[model samples]
Target: MALDIEQVRHVANLARLALSDEEIAVYQEQLSEILEYASSLAELDTEAIPPTAQVIALPGVTRDD
Candidate 1:
């Protein structure tokens, strides 16, 4: 999905950013690319994956006086 200049401008307005024409163009491209990449991640199949609190495997810590 391509983002239009007006959408970018609206985002900038919401963000309170006073972007110049050049900056708006640059940000529009970057934001669009980032969104596209994030969208691609939605294709992952995680039906058999288990949810965990942490990525690194570690035992719980304990303290004794």
Candidate 2:
């Protein structure tokens, strides 16, 4: 699940980013770790479980401009 530097660079390029070598290297590791952690969620079994529910409701507040 490790993301390579090339892939990160490609994504940055698609977003029109101008990343330096240091930044690219940093993202390569950070993004890889994130993907690895997220992939662990695939092992969860939610078939018989109820969907996630909201614990609290927040009343909407709006300011009239």
Candidate 3:
């Protein structure tokens, strides 16, 4: 789905952002691209992948005996 300028304006207002005309235009394009990329990620198949809470592997910390 494409993001409209009005939507961007609404989001900026909700975020308490005071954007200039140029800044609003730039954010509108950047935010639209980000949303489009995120949408593409939904097509991936992850049935065999296990869910993880963290990206790095580490042993549990414990006090020394």
| TM-score of model 3 vs. true structure | 0.79
Which should have the higher lDDT, number 2 or number 3? 3
Ordered list by lDDT, greatest first: 1, 3, 2
Question: lDDT of all predictions, in order shown?
Answer: 0.91, 0.90, 0.91
All candidates: TM-score: 0.76, 0.72, 0.79
lDDT of 1: 0.91
* lDDT preference between candidates 1 and 2, better one: 1
Lowest lDDT block of 10, candidate 2? 51-60
True-vs-predicted CA distance for residue 16, candidate 1, Å: 0.4
Instruction: Give the true-structure RMSD of model 3.
Output: 1.8
Any idea what lDDT model 2 has?
0.90
Clash pairs detected, candidate 1: none
Ranked by TM-score from best down, the candidates are 3, 1, 2
lDDT of 2 at 21: 95
**Total clashing pairs in model 2:** 0
Q: Summarize candidate 2's per-residue lDDT along 1-65 as a digit string, tens digits.
A: 98888999999999999999999999999999998888899878879986655667667678777
Clashing pairs in 2: none
